[model samples]
Target: MKVVIAGGHGKIAMLLHPILEEKGHTVKGLIRKEEQADDLRKAGAEPVVVDLEKEDDISEYVGEADAVVFAAGAGPGSGKERKWSVDRDGATKLMEAAKKNDIERYVMISAMGLETPRGDDVFQVYQQAKLQADKALRNSGLNYVIIKPGRLTNDEGTGKVKIAEKLDRGEIPREDVARVIAEILEDDTIEDVEFDLLSGDDEIKVALQEFV
Candidate 1:
């Protein structure tokens, strides 16, 4: 599979690149800065420089790919505007690009517990933006999978996870989340579904098999 990931320089995405490469899939990462190219290259992904915030039409940047993953975010420190732009608009743009390019598979990295707004004003906006983006993907005619994980941490992955339609508020390592995304990308049987993820006792494949 030829996979393109938005927010290529992100921690989770950087971890995902080498895993996909080892699985014999071509990986391309979309980055905003030319300086980030070397980092992506070292991580086993080709870097395509395009600012998601500034680009109006990003179809060309998306190009031809078997699948696309929306992993971009405006960050916790960013204000409300960037939340809408990068998290919501950027994802929709990729959806449009996917439709235009005839790519059927799209995977979204969303957050768990976004149904009800919470947190401070900016965070509430972030939740709203992410929820809106997930809804757009659901409505989109393309084959899509939305993986909504709980709070993310930098701890080492356990290679085990629990997945369900709705999971209680919990946390998972960024590495494990990347592992789940990689698994979903490779498994064509998993589609048109959304789930919450967290660290657990079940092996990654076993947990995913339950969904299948």
Candidate 2:
């Protein structure tokens, strides 16, 4: 299967690229900065420079992809307005592009506690932006997997994973989260379902069995 990642430079995407490529699936990364392209290419994913906020310019790429993954996010260094633009509006635009291209399978990586974004919260803007994008994917009538991961860390991968359908607040490894997304691409049982994810020491397939 061919998979197109919207944010190839992201932490989860970094983990996913190698795993997907090793599994023999063609991978393409939608990137913004030209510098990211070299990194993505080195990771074995074809990189396409396309800003998420202006996806109309790259509708052709979205149309050709067999599956789409929304793994991009505005970095911590970016301002609040940029979060809204890249996380909220940018995600919505990608979903629109998916619709226009008739792409049915989509996976969106979101935050664990995104439903509420208190003004004083340090990540309030990010929460709001993610909530909007996540909600859109939930309502989008496609084979979608919305994986909301908890506080991300740079810890080395443990491969253990968990899947909760409702809201969850478990800490998950970025690598573990990436594995879940890639596993879903191969598993058909979780079709049209959304799950909250966290790090564990067990295989994601075994962890998600009940939900499936």
Candidate 3:
């Protein structure tokens, strides 16, 4: 399968690239900066430089991929405006590109607890943007999976996870999240599912099997 990921230079995307490649899937990452191209190449993905914020049409960038992943974000340091552009509008464009390119599978890296309100100022805007984007994908009539994880950590992954339609608020490592995405991409059986995730005693594949 061929996969295209938005925010290809992101922490999770970097971790995910080699995993997908090892599984024999071709990967392409869409990045905003020319410098980030080398980093993506090192991670075993073809890097395409395209600023999601400036570009209106992205079908050419997504070209001939089996799946698309929206891992892009407007980072915590970014102001509220970028939350709308990168988090919301950026994701919207990816969906459009996927449809135009006839890509059926989409996996969204969304935030947990978006239905409830939290945070002050910019954080709130971020939540709203993600929620809107998730809604758009659900309505897009595409085979989609929305992985909404709790507080993310940089700790080592245990290769275990607890996944459900809605899991209690908890934390999981970024490595584990990347592994989960790789597994989801390889298995076409998992479709139109949205779940919250956290570290747990169950094996990742087994836990996902229960929900997907």
Clashing pairs in 2: 160-200, 172-199
lDDT of candidate 1 over 82-129, digit per residue (tens): 999999999999999999999999999999999877899999999999
> How big is the positional error of residue 64 in model 1, measured in Å on the Cα after superposition?
0.6
Q: For each candidate, C-alpha RMSD in Å?
A: 0.6, 1.9, 0.7
Residue 80's lDDT within candidate 3 is: 96
> How does each model score on TM-score?
0.99, 0.91, 0.98
| lDDT-better candidate, 1 vs 2 | 1
Best by lDDT: 1
The weakest ten consecutive residues by lDDT in model 3 span 203-212
Q: Candidate 1 local accuracy as lDDT? A: 0.95
Question: What C-alpha lDDT do the candidate models reach, one value each?
Answer: 0.95, 0.80, 0.94
Error of 2 at 9 (Å): 1.3
What TM-score quantifies how close candidate 1 is to the native fold?
0.99
Return whichever of 2 and 3 wins on lDDT: 3
Instruction: Between candidates 2 and 3, name the one with more favorable TM-score.
Output: 3
Error at 191, model 2, angstroms: 1.6
